[model samples]
Target: MSITEQIRSLEELASVDAELKILEDQLNQERSTLDALRGSLQKLEDKLKTDRAHIAALDKTRSDLVAEVRQMNQQIEHSREKMNRSRNEREANAAQRELEELRKLLRDREEEIGKLTTEAEGARQGIEGTEGEASKISAELGSQEGDISSRLSEVESQKAKRVTDREVAAKKLPPVLYRRYEQIRSKRGTGIAQTSDGTCKACNMALPPQLFHRLRREPLLDQCPSCNRIIYFVSPAAAAQPVKEG
Candidate 1:
């Protein structure tokens, strides 16, 4: 291939490769997003499970407290009946003291039941709130599933087309030049670098005056001394042409 044809083929291949890279990057980002969404869903599910377990524990506590309160009530009633049956002053005094102690015990048990009831209510509310949030997240995830899948399919199709184009473009160059381009690309991610105003755009380094003159005079491929990337010069008119993909 002539020097100009070689540069054109390389440029076309580079363009396609760049596009393919973009598509691949997009695919990676989309996959990450899907993974993140699923992770969030898993977290919500775990939290919901924990909340349910907490509520169950609270309910058991409340039931135990209620049973204790009922027992205390029955004991206080029996103490009251014993006080009514007292005959002498000493017996009445003793019965009165006994009744006071039983009432105090009953009051303490009722207080505990009240506290547990409140705690159980709070736990119930927590379960409701968590369930609502999980539902919202589930809906949002469901909505994104179709869109992500469609975008992934489209990106894969585009990447396949670009790969084909790149193969065709690579075939146009001589074997030695193609191998050299691949070597540079492997190291630097881009093999071809355009030059502007005596500067290598890739490395942003100044080209030697002699080298720049040679590049302009000879129809040959040249490498940047600083970065070793294939260099090409574009005239003002040529640069103005609309860039097209091969």
Candidate 2:
């Protein structure tokens, strides 16, 4: 193929490569988001489990306290009956003291039960809040997964077609030229750059008059000295028209 035709083919391949890179980057970003969502959900689930365990422990403590309080109440009732049966003042006073001590123990146990009950309520609330958050995240993750899957399929299809096009374009060029194009693309992300009005479009550097003249006369691919990119000259008519930036 002629150098001009070869340049055109390289340009086509470069366009395809650019598109593929964009699709791949997008796919990676979506996958990363999916991973982050899953990680967050796992952490929330772990926290919920811990909170439930804490509540269970608190419930057991409360139950033990209740049983102790009941036992204390029974002891106080027996002490009261003993005081009623006491004949002497000294024995009656001793029975009263015993009853007071039993009552005190019962009060202390009840207070502990109240505290434990409050703590268990707090833990239950925490679990509810965490479950709500997890549900929200799970719904969002589901939607995102669907979108990513569809987008991935579309991107893969387009990428496959572009790969085929790139292969066909590469085959048209001489092996040496094709290799040079690949090397430049690897470094600069673009191999072929169009020039307009004596300026290298890729680097926006002004080309020397002599080099521009050579580019027009030589009919072979030329590299820009400043940027080392493959450069092509456009006709004045094309140059006069506004060119869109890539």
Candidate 3:
């Protein structure tokens, strides 16, 4: 390619690189959001599983306590009836002692049942709250997943096209120039830069007056002294060309 043609190709390659970067950033951000949503959902599900297991254990304990308390009440009644029929003070006192023991055990069991009931209720309430949060996150994830997937597909498609464009642009340059451009892009994120008013815009440094004048008068492949980026001068007409066309 002629020097001017090669400059145009470099510009086109730069544009493609810029677009590709934007596409990559979009993809990363979207994927990160999707992963975070999935992670949150998984945590909530795990907590629900553990809480349900705890509530089940509490229920089993409460049931056993209730049954024991009922049996104790029956024993207390039996002791009272026996005391009523006792013929002497010794038998009556023995029945009274048995009744007191049964009542104390029943009281303790009832208190245990009460504490278990409170714990179970608290756990149930926590589950309800977690479920509500999970539901909200689920709905949001469902909606976001579809939208982000569509957007990611579109970005990938655009990136593919830009890649092809970059390849074509790269091929237009001489091999040496292409390799140099690639090296510069790898290190600096961009290979070429423009000059205006004797300054290398890439580095904000003044170009050599002799070099700047020559670049403006004739197209050439050159590098800025300060930044080492490929340098070009934008003639008034060239500057007016549409960016994509250039």
By lDDT, the best candidate is 3
The numbered model that scores best in TM-score is 1
Pairs clashing within candidate 1: none
- Compared with the true structure, all predictions reach lDDT values of 0.80, 0.82, 0.86
Clashes of 3: 0
> All candidates: CA RMSD in angstroms?
4.5, 4.5, 4.8
lDDT ranking, best first: 3, 2, 1
Q: Is candidate 2 or candidate 3 better by TM-score?
A: 3
Model 3 stretches with alpha carbons more than 4 Å out? 60-112, 208-218, 236-246
Stretches of candidate 2 exceeding 4 Å from the true structure? 29-40, 60-113, 239-246
lDDT of 2 at 75: 91
Model 1, residue 82: C-alpha shift (Å): 6.7
lDDT digits (tens) for residues 1-246 of candidate 1: 678888888888888877887898999999898888888888978988887788788778778877877886787788778778888888888878887887887788678778877887887788788788878878888999889999999999998988888889899989998999899888887788776467777787899988877776766579989888888777645652322221
TM value for model 2: 0.69
- TM-score between model 3 and native: 0.70
Candidate 3, residues 58-159, lDDT tens digits: the string is 999999999998899999999999999999999999999999999899899999999999999999999999999999999999989999999889988988
Model 3 residue 192 lDDT score: 84
Q: Candidate 2 residues 1-246, lDDT tens each?
A: 777787667767777777788877887887788889999999999999889889999999899888888888889889999999999999999999999888888888888999999999988988999999999999999988898788878878887887888788778878888888888777777777767567887877888988888776766568888777788776766652222233
